[model samples]
Target: MHEFTPPSGTLLGVGLGPGDPALITLKAADAVARTRVLAVPVKARGAESFARRIVAGRITPAHTVLELVFPMRSDPEVLRPHWQRAAQAILTHLDRGEDVAFLCEGDPFTFGTFIYVFREVARLRPHAPVEVIPGVSAYHAAACRTLTPLAAGDDRLCVLPATYGVEVVETMLERFDTVVLLKVKPVMDALLDMLARTGLTGHAVFVNKVGTDEEAVVTDVASLRGRKLDYLSLMLVRNPARVKEPVLRGCRPKVGA
Candidate 1:
């Protein structure tokens, strides 16, 4: 006599968009609705989860919400254990044939906490079913809301965390036409100073909590100096005066001959 084993359920990384419930895609909503276990990331135990709040309306009594604590720190060693624990917790439900959907504020693979968990899950279960549902990133929403064109004909764009320091940011600004600085809370003043030094202060825009009711956009980025900013804030900078290589089209040079 032989005993049969049930197959594991799938792990769904659902991006809910940038703080806007309406921005969630139809497929993401369907996944959330069908999944019985909803794994949400929070800063601490019992803390509010921004990702969960984005899909509050979709949650029902039948759903089992699992809060995974992911502290706000950049130390990978400190975060690794948390990620492994979260992955194991989600896997437990999956082993029971219950699909687990991990909610994310933006695109799961774009600097989202889901990436860490996803990596751990893949390591733990090499053949586990997984699906990633993309959503509008914070920078994309900020650019669209500000009506700023990220890139155009031969223009380059760079997106990085502001914690990389002002020197690196300045170098990126020099190399790319458009630069998006994410999580500008710690280096707000330094970035503003660098922008002013590069004569791009007026071309920079600061967007905070984009797409939500408390969203704010600041055209005068200089005013943000010395002021505490939210972690969700980001800056979109455009350098129109950046030197571009001459493109020869039909025997005619676009720039100086």
Candidate 2:
């Protein structure tokens, strides 16, 4: 006699795209529709998740919603437990042979909370079926909204977390033709100063909550000096003049008459 085996449920990391419901891909929509359980993450209890809000209209009564509260902390020690707890919660549905879709804002692999939860889930349930659906990243959305081409021809691009400090950003600005600084809130002021000193103020653009109603774009980096911005804000810098410098390349600059 053949042995009977139960099918394990699939865990989907569904990326909703940058804050727009319109940006959700067809495959992501299908995943959302087919999944029996929807796992959403919020910063705190009672707080709304932008990820869930993106697909609010699509969620039917047939779907079971699970809210996973992840503490808003940068420390790994503090975040690990929350991730594990959320993973355990999602596993219950998977154990029942029901698919669970964890809603994520922006691309699931691009600094999405789904990455953490997915990691923990994988660790606990090694054989659990999991699939990731890619969505439009925040930086891509910001670039499109600003009508800025990330790179063209031989132009090199680099993306770094601005939380690494102004010194690191200063180095990257001199190295790449296009530099994207994510998580700009904590270091906005210092970054602004560095931009001014490097004469890249005019070449830089700041975007916050791209594709959302709270979206703000600042072409003038100087204006951001005293202003408070959202944590989701990022700065895109295209330093043609800096790129012309010989330090980045092995050539000397020709002075124009």
Candidate 3:
């Protein structure tokens, strides 16, 4: 006779939104409320987990919280092991038919730590059930708070980490009508100088921790130079004078048409 085996539980990647608990989607909240095991990403052992903090009110004693360390480093070699270990930790719970919800600050697929763990989970358990619940991204929240339109008419938009260097940013500014620079802490001064050089200092606005009590919006972006910025900070710039591409007939219709 063949032996029966219990099926593994589902792995959920829940986005809690950008630092604001209210921004969490209904689906994401339901996932967190129902799941017994919660995997949260932390910068170090015993360090605060921003994702966990966003949902602090929802966490009860019945929930089993697991903190997974994901240091603020870009080196893949150093990050791979952590991802593997976090995956294994979550897998341990899944094997027991217990759902594990990995909480993230923003949309799970948008520069969120959940992506790394999701990758490892897929590799380790190829057939495991997985679901990603999307939430409001930081840039979207920043744009909404500042009342800035990310794109209008035929305008183009670009979003990337400011660590790509000022040269790349400058090129992007010339090409795209709107550009959102994430994690500008490392290159704040350089970016300020470049914006001034291009006469775009007035066109940029700095926002950090949008949608939260600690949220900040700076209209004078140049003043941010020499000041330390949080890793959660970002800049939204609009180049209204950017040359628009001519629309070829039959290619695409005009915005109002």
Candidate 4:
């Protein structure tokens, strides 16, 4: 008699899009439909998962929902071990030939928790079959909702987390034609000052939870003073006064000439 071999299941990183269920791609929807084990990331135990909420309608009774806690902290030392543990838990299901799909908000690869878990899974299980489905990032949705152009011909764009400090944002504003600042909660006050100082305050727009019921758009940044902003909020700034200095490739002319 021939021995029976159980095939390992595939690991899929599905992006749920910004915050709207309608934004979910058909491919992601199909993945959620066929998923036997769905892995969802939560900020803490017992807390609702935003990623899960984005695809709540797709989850069926046959799907085993697994909640993975990834705390809302910036410290890598604190986060790495937690994700490693989550990867082990998901791997157990995959080993049993159960297809696992990890739900992520926004694009899975863009500043999302799925990347950390995905890396850990790949490191531990090199031969594991894995696939990633990209979705609309928050900045994209925010720009669309606010009718702001991220960039045009010969324009430069810079996107970075606002946690890097006010000085970093100042530098980005000076260099790039457009700057998209994510997670602006930590340095909201400082950023407001920087924007005003740079004479770019009117060009900035703030959007929170785009396409959801909690969505709020603020064109007047001054109103943000002493206000508590949501963690999901972002700021998109455009600098029309910014000038790109031409880089001379040939020999420079004499100063006297």
Candidate 5:
């Protein structure tokens, strides 16, 4: 091992985008390449890492890679300390003037755990240079993989977490012409119920593990109830008003014009 002293350095949180290797941004690739140390988070003992799998073909063994074990379950007491320690580990590398890159799946800011590092690093060492490279979010990837569109014509689309309560989801369904729910692993039932209540269930589509080998898409959300899922998945509900026939009928009906 080697010794170290405090030095100015950059901490790059690079998003690998969705599972498709080609989707990774070129700039993100450069960040990974230049980093003297790469920090990849680990779940439990001997578990396959989703982030690592996304960038497996690009990383080299010569670079220093650190695994910070983060508990998958959300326990208020357990999470903060783990994340705090993880930030310290990363900061240690950065303190040595070594550029450290944290590999993230999809966009680092959207429903991402990297923000834990971002917050702590900001709190503990505010001067550290931080760079966040945008990557393909599961939002567009899920829609594209399922051959669906986020919106059509003048229709407005909203993207939100499916974990929202039934009341909020019901409001969103009525407000937006197209709704995309991200990180849908926990509240599948609530989402399905909202769709069913709105009578849009028949047209809803569920896409799981987008861009990865395990990817699966189902046009019927009704069949998806009570099943296992991935946090990386998303669903799209086609709006009737977004179709050609319906929109052509609405232009003359919206009021005096």
Candidate 6:
């Protein structure tokens, strides 16, 4: 057996992947296996750990799961207080020399709540080591779930939160080579309406709970007219022929050989 090193003082913002625990990257899995404390969100008296559920099968009682309560509202009045509390909890762990693996649902740097702690801890203790482990983002999982290639040779890829309304989506359809609409709960209906009218509906796919038992992939946007959806879902629409740069376009010299 190898010597077990004492926990070094560091913070690892680990990504748990989209939904399936099996999809977690090898590096992320190693981080989880080594995490001393796993911080999770606890809302109200009985809210689910939507993020942790992504890795439920992999976690064990041996791994400490710390719940950091977060308010369900984004009201300016309540937001700061919740963030402060979350930061305090993580800082407490750091002070103990136990590295914290703050698990996030997707890429740690991409919309992960771990930033709140990252900023606060760095501000207070400038020399703390912080490392981010990348995982399979929702868009990548969704695209794979639907078997849709995001980009081709020289094809562009743009991922945007679905908080934008129909108008913004229409604008994206106009300019981008491909679009992955995330956090798509609120505007599913309106966006579907826009895609239908714009004739882009056929190329779009609605993906939910990818890589899990509840995973779903729908080709018809209108089919989801009034259905309930998990917030972890995404919509992928691609048009690969937009800017096909010929690999051999510049193969020959400008002047004849």
> Rank order by TM-score, top first?
3, 1, 4, 2, 5, 6
CA lDDT of every candidate: 0.92, 0.88, 0.92, 0.91, 0.81, 0.78
Alpha carbon lDDT of residue 13, candidate 3?
94
In the order shown, the candidates' Cα RMSDs to the true structure are: 4.3, 5.9, 2.6, 5.4, 6.2, 5.6
The residue ranges of model 5 lying beyond 4 angstroms of the native Cα positions read 1-6, 75-77, 152-154, 241-257
Per-residue C-alpha lDDT of model 4 across residues 93-194, encoded as one tens digit per residue: 989988899999999999988898999999988888999999999999999999999998768899999899999989998899999999999899999999
The collision pairs in model 4 are none
On lDDT, who's better, 2 or 3? 3
Writing each residue's lDDT as its tens digit, candidate 2 over 54-90 gives: 8999999999999999987888899988999999999
Poorly placed runs, candidate 4 (over 4 Å): 1-6, 247-257
lDDT of 2 at 79: 91
* Model 5 lDDT at residue 107: 91
lDDT of 6 by residue, 12-77 (tens): 888878878777889988888888688887665467887778778778888988887766564646
Residue-level lDDT of model 1, residues 1-257, one tens digit each, is 87776788899999989988888999989989999899999999999999999999999999999999999999999999999999999999988888899999988988888998999999988778999999889999999999999999889999999998999999999889999999799999999889989999999999999989889999988899999899999999999888887665676666875
The superposed Cα distance between candidate 4 and the true structure at residue 150, in angstroms, equals 0.7
Clashing pairs in 2: none
Off by over 4 Å in 6: 1-8, 72-77, 239-257
RMSD of 6: 5.6
- On residues 1-257, what C-alpha lDDT tens digit does candidate 5 reach at each position? 78654665788889998889999999988888788688887787467678888988877877887887787866758888888988999888777787888899899988778998888998888888899998889878887777777776667788887666667766776777778887678888877877787789987888888888888888878888898887667788766744332445644666655
Q: Using lDDT as the measure, name the better of candidate 1 and candidate 5.
A: 1
